[model samples]
Target: MTELLSLSRAARLAGVTRAEIQKRIRHGEMQTFEGQVAISDLLRVYPSVSLEQSGDFERVEQIKAEAYPRSHDEDTRLPSQQVLITRIKALAEALVQRVARVEALEQLLEEVRARLDEMAADAGDKSGASAAAETQTHTQAQALRDLSAWLQTRRTDLAESAVEAAQTQLLARDSFLRIMSASVKMIPSGHEFFVDGNESILEAAVRSGLRLSYGCASGNCGECKARLVSGEVYRLREHDYVLSEREKQMGYLLTCSHTAVTDLQLEAAEAHSPADLPEQEIQAQIRKLEPQSGGLMLLHVQTPRTNTLRFMAGQRARLRLADGPEQELPIASCPCNGRNLLFTLRQGDDAFSQAVFETVTPRQPVTLTGPYGDFVLADATEPAVFIALGDGIAPIKSLIEHAVSIDSIEAFHLYWSVPAPRMHDHQPWCRALRETLDNFAFTPLVDAACDDLLALLESDLEALPDNRYYIAGPGSAVQAVVSTLLAAGVPQARIASEELD
Candidate 1:
């Protein structure tokens, strides 16, 4: 029997994670003997693998130059065969990029069609098909038809792109043509992982057995927010969060929908305990229901005092309605009052939201579980910045209250973005707080629409650096503002995010 290398050795030799080695094995990209692999087989599978290539193309050139001393007969240092291989690898990368662009275009086109349909329906409802309205409707219908035709055109373009890709056919031996991955450096612990061309940061991290806070893996939940300390990244999917320009400038990102474009440095907010959270469902009751402006409800809930749940401020819990399925919501009350909890949920036609606002009367029986999340305060004296939108203001309140009453902080700033003055219920409270608390500043950002959210935070972003940031909102709203913050270069270590879905 031939001696074979273990999975550990293969991972080490190939400069990849153990999960990556196993994945390649499952795909039959790397051959194995018995349950182990041969060194020759490993090298054959990864001909151009390197130990985190930061400017390594030059290193390869320098190594080649040092091996073959300069000669008078040949001015070109690269051999014809090597040059051809290099060109092929570059072409492969270009093909991958084109495919990605095509996929993004297809998704965008779908969104455009949906939006146009929605606009057409809304317009018809409002205008009652008047002459001018009918003309507009006709134009919209024509645009929709044109869009359908454009989609087909794009499909043809994609086919052409595929044909182009097929011309530069690749072979297993040409592993150098494999797509490149961006290396990510996790601050504080300094652990490193590579985000493959198709892998999002959260996916890569979790796959590699690293623990970070995340929720709903889908774009709807803004749970996987991190700070892109440095380097470029590209969005892989539509994000629900709307980020302010200031937040974009600060470097916040939702790791579930974005992929690293270059060697990166990121900061992650992770759970305090390494072990998985043990969820225990228990009996609870609706203690109070305070109606806020618009379709928002401030629901107060309380579990049995005997079995109090422990969770960080800004953490979330699942609220089970009498006639509805369970809904995940952030606790508006801090952990100081664990058994007695307050929650904020939007009033909607859905069973859960409706139950909270109308059906579920005070003192009604309910089921509750959790105190789950890693959106607690950072252990720093730096100024804290909190941004809350719509019902997302719930968890931010818990954090803000904690900062004022429990923990000692250097300073803190709070920006509340709401649609109208009727929704500005907390203005007087926050203004009074500013007068009483020397370290606190509150800004009421009325009429702050999703697209222009960060405009209110411009001056604050310029003043705050390496300060703790906590954002709570609908996933899309959170993602948008977080992306802006990340683009603004906010260190990921100082940011924490959670979403109410």
Candidate 2:
């Protein structure tokens, strides 16, 4: 028999009213295993609920069905939206408080320094009290050290708080702007507005129903790059090393990174269709997990639902592990046999990978939270070439499979490379693809034994009939290929790639 919880107990654990729990249960919206509600159901209804209660748990299938009859979906429930908005607001407010605290601490430090100066001045005037002066000096130095350490800590806190504030603001703003921009009218004669204040213009714009172009949303990818038509944008974080000074001077601002100090009018470089940005979540069972090579694992995930996942070939998903924290891993291969989803995991010596390989098990429930990334083959008309190194072949493989599935027999070539023949264990799949997919050619570049990878890329470019190129691989390899492509006269805009580092 399932251990049952009364409505009151479930409500208390869920941080909701007993009436609400009864209403949901009565409506048959929530599932109870043998008349006992699972703690997990409460969590789905109230994600922010404290995890202090311990017990066996059941999963809730549809909170909205029982809780809010008019709610569109469980994800769209007021509780979930409230959780997101409240958390975002709280984060923003906390950042402001931290900044204020840091400023106050700095002022106190200055005061302490001034007091020490006064003490030093008094000590200088006393000649006969030399011993007392020395003792006082030592005490003052120690005090100064303590104050300095405190100040440093405060500064660090302030820096961290600032980054948090910026990130929260960006997310909120992006969410708002993307929804807004979809329906807004654009003026034929572009209007310029300056971005002023620490408030996120993107968020404001999003809230106002404008969508903006952005990538990584972390300021690392320049996909959100925009020209500051006017006004100054003070960057809150110093991690945007990806953007060059010249780019900044050119008024190029990363919407995710820049806050407007002045009212700013900027144009979005990319526009996405409404259907392209649907929010989706996938539940899957861990079917198989095996070590493919050193530090890399081949993961086969199976979803029970027959709903087709319409994702672009090169797009990536956020994988929420059953045992470990979430990770963003690219779908390394295409969906095979219309049943299994495939991905490659290169175990970087991180806590995430260690948990996945060493601790996570098959039959575990994993959730995927995405279909993000515009690195796919967006235009069917454009003749394209694909390049990948090592496990970077994941996205390329997706694109190829998608292209073949759609009967797009356009001129497509794949150049895939691994360290050696031993690492080419998955090469049989590549050969199979080439054999089945007409108009598709594969070039396998093995290390040391063949012509240099870069040289081969250059030669391939020479023979290509004016086509766009997509490259994905390690940072250095991608850069080398991009440089070669750019030097070989391919337009920068036509050369699309993603650096996962």
Candidate 3:
């Protein structure tokens, strides 16, 4: 029998994204059986990945250290004791079933041996039986002996194969991952993510960049209610909203208050586009204001815990300071963390930008509303090119982060052009992204002309018509890039642009 692994687990074990695995399958480099890869195939394709020193396991650790250094505490790598015990019990039951099957096979083998011995004895009693019958009995006994020997040898081969050290270690690592995190598969949309630590299902979904519908994250409004289709869950908090008896009978639960105890499948609502998200007004507090290069300010704000902002990445939000007019600015942070949002503000003569740049202190109250824009990423698996110019890097940054969270894009190429004086400001970040993501490339252009930018894009991309393009910059620059792409036979529907001016 062939040992098979799910695509998600195979990707985790191989230390690559699921999209990378799918790409290989699409290119006929790898094979799958019913959406699962054979363990032998996985090992063959990712020979560099193993549990040995400096292998796939260590590569994963390195990525965690670099990309998500503050993701969780070291002590929290294990699941809760109760959940751990349940998993162990499940494993034990599977072991018991296998053992019973082995015993039954042994008994059947003993019976076959006894029957062969009886046949051999009958063959020797030639006086009472015909000569032809005796000859047939002896032949049957010899054939049975040979078959028994082959079965025993085959069983030994299977036993040795089952204990292959490298594959054994791979499976052990997968079990360890299960202990640390539980996978969740959303129904209808078929989206998936892992629930790390003891975070609620809603929290994990949002953190994974899936825009699941929700109102109050504290479970007061029951907007996060979902029917449990499979897996175990534990309530992390008590919710005041009572479920109908019929809903309760159907396993309805509040995702905001429940944490997954095992891999789960739930019928949950998700926002596929910006239009799916409702208009929300959140009174957030200014977390901090950090000055960046080229007269730009990084404004950090934290929304209330109960009411977090719900929006897609690369969208704009209207922010207003006390006694100041609202200013619409592109959000510079990933939608993964709606509670703590970031905005990139150019410190121009505008009142809102000046207030944020000069006088906005930490914990200052700010009115945040209107996650307004249609400049969100498409739900396609094609390669994407992101072009950001100067301060326009804000929205592009959010889009890149969101794409990384989803880990579904086939490839990504980022082109960032800033004035000569501010060229070095974002280089460090671009370098980090290049080091972390296997499918990402970054090119920096300092005060580049339109020809220079277009030349780089033409040289970097394999095909212009096949990939999606997203551009953010001054209105004139964005229009120029868009026109060039359209003239190059790129479809208008494959391009998305945001004017930063």
lDDT for each candidate structure: 0.64, 0.56, 0.81
What's the residue-level lDDT of 459 in candidate 3? Answer: 87
Q: Give a tens-digit lDDT track for model 3, residues 332-410.
A: 8778878878887777887777777777799999999978999999999889999998878889988988887777788
Top of the candidates by TM-score: 3
Error of 2 at 260 (Å): 53
- Candidate with top lDDT is 3
lDDT of 1 by residue, 1-501 (tens): 233555644554455434456667767887777557865566567665444442423332233233222211223322234333444555567669877987897799778767766765655556656798788777877676677667767767866773333322222212332234445777765555655436567766653334466655556656677888887677767887766677678898888777766557898865455134456577888888888777777787876643545566777888887766678888776554456677877767777876666667988888887767777776555678888876678889878765553323556788888756547665665776576554578887865664565555665555544567898877887887788777767777777887766
For every model shown, what is its TM-score relative to the native structure? 0.44, 0.43, 0.89
Candidate 1 structure lDDT: 0.64
Which stretch of 10 consecutive residues in model 1 shows the poorest summed lDDT?
68-77
- Model 2 residue-pair collision total: 27
Q: After TM-score superposition, what is the CA distance of residue 291 in candidate 1 from its true location, in Å? A: 2.0
The residue-level lDDT of candidate 1 at 377 comes to 74
Candidate order, lDDT descending: 3, 1, 2
lDDT of 2 at 243: 64
Worst 10 residues of 3 by lDDT: 65-74
